[model samples]
Target: MNELKDKVALITGGTKGIGLGIAQALLSQGIHVAITSRSAKAAEETAKQLNSSATKARAIGVKADVRDFESQQNAVRLVLSEFKQLDFVIANAGLGHFASIEELTLEQWQDTIDTNLTGAFYTIKASVEALKKSKGYYISISSLAGANFFAKGAAYNASKFGLTGFTQAVMLDLRQHGVKVSTIMPGSVSTHFNGNEPDSSDDWKIQIEDIGELVVDLLKMNPRALPSKVEVRPTMPPSK
Candidate 1:
């Protein structure tokens, strides 16, 4: 586990929600991190605050549009520039666009698929080489929706389901190279996802820090062990 410390990580959409939670958890473990967002200011501000914490783990905020391969590649470049090594990459930048097939717009469908699915591919393509060099870990924050279907969730379901399959397949392709890959699918996380602000009323939802701890634990697993896919749900949700 001592080897886990002092590693460098790059997380997409790390300015808030699950990404930020994961960053804090890793930083406390002495890992340097670079988090990206669509908004430059938000990313910079959040990075500044994290750096100010006594953890003393360096943090950098980068502006990136995960939907674009070049943007993701640039983020990778920035992370290497800062930390000189890449150890962990989290493809967490995702957005949901839910609507019935009849109501979903072309733009909405494209945006959802591009950001959640193809974006993950771009991240992996850009970082896999660096990760291979360090025998690093690649984790994607997926959703239970990848397996469960609901009405008016065509786009979101497609993206997550694709993500689950994509990450798993890549896991097989990369394991021999010594890079561990995993996907975390949470039932419902209390975060500012889909524009819903988390409140005390959201106690029933899975907390972001729980997901963060899960990531750290995965990193600490024995070299011979690989839990490629994880399913996490709230112990209890409001009784319905």
Candidate 2:
């Protein structure tokens, strides 16, 4: 039997892209998963697809918005009610709005910060107790933009930077409880973010499954070692 068999995970914004990829990977490793989305239809359909592909493990859909604390609390409650234990939580819901600082609207900036930064805060807060019980893991999907700044990326950069710092601090706060925390910072991922539809041209970028594999590796590592933060990038990119 798989050592991770029957472990459970809750993934925020898991209806598509990176979140969906991680759900699939965990299910394959015999982990039950609850995937949340703001859209009820997308969450349910994606869960159905994952269930069909998985062998022993199961998947469920939850309609939750990470930006709202109550909604995140409800998601964690529902997962614990169904799975009886929570072993991992991945904060993967995020968005980017690119424009010059002067052109960035207040609404865009707020949405970016709320969804990418505050949302992660809510996710971990909601799930922390459950994780402490299971000695589980928490992983946030941040980005390379957290460390690198560029014009027209004000909102995105701010959110990711804040998320990276937040996860590190939380790691210190939770390590004594036997819970592990880490943030994944990926560069040039081929996901449908920032209104960019994935296509063949994105082949050189990091695939969602690649991130999925990385999450699995982190979970499977020995408990004595903690990779507090990880930065991932495509091996090669078309030269400028």
Candidate 3:
């Protein structure tokens, strides 16, 4: 715990699942966190739930769609206005569409790529100036699909693969400017991703909190050391 007290963090898609988990983790560490989602109502509700009378005020939630550059830019502006300085950003807004290449519609492919890959680009691009000013950190939430393709996952696999490459390149580009970049690739997290209810059957999946804890760990690492990339998976899964 490198004492994240007073540090400001901006998380996209922070209203639920992995993003929410990460926001909660940062809040527990006394970090001033601001989260964004497409829905204004959801964001406000999540912020209320995460807020505390102690620990540097809870979190601020804003409405921003990752697929839109203007929306992401507005999110950055909101973070800067609320926190005065931005220390870290997590681009966690994404969607998965699973379909074989032959079965995938052109719209489906574009939607997945736009939301998962280009969305991250919008998020990071909008926040770069603030990050540079604070020598901050950028963490992209990737997935195992980024490297290991699965059946009927053409769209998802392509997006994650592109994201992984993009994250690495950004890491190299930002390091010299004092901004650290890293990607967290998690395997089968038990989240309500793709609009499914999270259930006990998903126990074999990595818990959302597991990813949150990893993010906390990354933030606490010494500035001189950058992990660059992390790949996480459950030690054991249910027998198929």
lDDT of all predictions: 0.93, 0.95, 0.91
N/CA/C clash count, model 2: 0
Where does candidate 1 clash, by residue pair? none
Model 3, 60-130: lDDT tens digits are 98999999999999999988888799999999999988877899999999999999999999999999999
All candidates: TM-score: 0.98, 0.98, 0.96
Clashes of 3: 0
Model 2 segments more than 4 A misplaced: none
Candidate 3 residue runs with Cα over 4 Å from true position: 52-56
Tens-digit lDDT track of model 2 for 130-162: 999999999999999999999999999999999
lDDT (0-100) at residue 108 of candidate 3?
Answer: 96
Candidate 2 residue 26 C-alpha distance from true site, Å: 0.5
Clashes of 1: 0
